[model samples]
Target: MKVGVVTFPGSLDDVDAARAARLAGHDAVSLWHGDHDLKGVDAVVLPGGFSYGDYLRCGAISRFAPVMSEVLTAAQGGMPVLGICNGFQILCESHLLPGALIRNDHRKFGCLDQRVRVENTSTPWTSSYAQGQELTIVLKNGEGAYVADEVTLDRLEGEGRVVVRYVGNPNGSLRDIAGVTNERGNVVGLMPHPEHAVEDLTGPGTDGIGFFTSLLESAATA
Candidate 1:
């Protein structure tokens, strides 16, 4: 499988995401934010970064990138897309996913090893894990709190679209949400950095590999 990792200005983790994909036994493709083409990748990953220096808002500027337009169309058509950290903010800005990421209730930048529970495994991005699996993924962001209207939040929970929840509520995200999946389960937006934990030599453990492997497994099954 070939996974495309999009790189926007100031993006910090695009290479890490690509490395994780290659480590998972697949080809990693580099995609530029200015380019409209995806290079025919099977899946796409919007890695973490402060696009446009978080000018207007986190990922607010990146939401209008040329590559993002292609990503939006592909994601709507069922292509799997994973957004991590700042990328998650972009996904919300693009309206491919719901809700918004806001400043931490403490009004501070947070960085730590956060534990998150996998709530929905039906998505291709998470199909390799069992339900309720907990992972200690890296979490670092200034504005990572996820917020949505009560009705929308209730709907997400009701439809089982809340793909991951914080085990310890580190960022004060509403209802402890750490990640979420789209209605079709093809697009996912996560604040924690799973790519940082994909290798035992560098990260917490190899638990993060499943996020990448799951994509390959899901495609094979389909």
Candidate 2:
């Protein structure tokens, strides 16, 4: 499988996301934010970063990037896309996923090893894991709290779209949501940084490998 990792201005984790993809035995392509082409990648990842220096709003400016236009279309066409940290903000800004990330309830930047429970493992991005499985990944962000209207939250819960929830309420996200998937389960967004935990030598551990490996396994099944 070939996965593309998009790099926007000020993006800090594009290379790490690509490395994780490669470590999972897939070709990792570096995609530029200004490019409209996807280069025929089977899947895409909008890695964590402070694009445009988080001007206007976190990921608010990046939602208008040329690459995001393509990503939006591809994602609607059932292309699997994973958004992490700042990328998750962009996904919400683009309306690709539900809920909005706001300032942490503590009103401070949080950086720690966060434990998240896999709620729905049927999505293409999480199919490798069993439901209710818990894993720890690096979480670092200033505005990572996820919030939504009660109706929307109900719909998300009723439809089984809530993919991951925090084992501990670290960011004060609503209902302890750490991650979520779109209706079709093709697009997923999360506040934690899985790319930072894909390797044992340089990261916390290999707990993050499933995010990449699951994509490959999903593709094979498809």
TM-score of each: 0.99, 0.98
lDDT of 2 by residue, 1-222 (tens): 889999999999999999999999999999999998999999999999899999989999999999999999999999999999999999999999988999999999999999999999998888888989998899999999999999999999999999889998998899999999999999999999889999889878878889999998898889
Global local distance difference test of model 2:
0.93
lDDT string, candidate 1, 116-187, tens digits: 999999999899999999998999999999999999999999999999999989878999999998999999
Predicted model with the maximum lDDT = 1
**Which pairs of residues collide in candidate 2?**
none
Q: How close is candidate 1 to the true structure, as a TM-score?
A: 0.99
Model 2: how far residue 116 lies from native, Å: 0.6
Alpha carbon lDDT of residue 105, candidate 2? 98
Q: Please give the CA lDDT of all the candidate structures.
A: 0.94, 0.93
Weakest 10 consecutive residues of candidate 1 by summed lDDT:
199-208
How far out, in Å, is residue 54 in model 2?
0.7
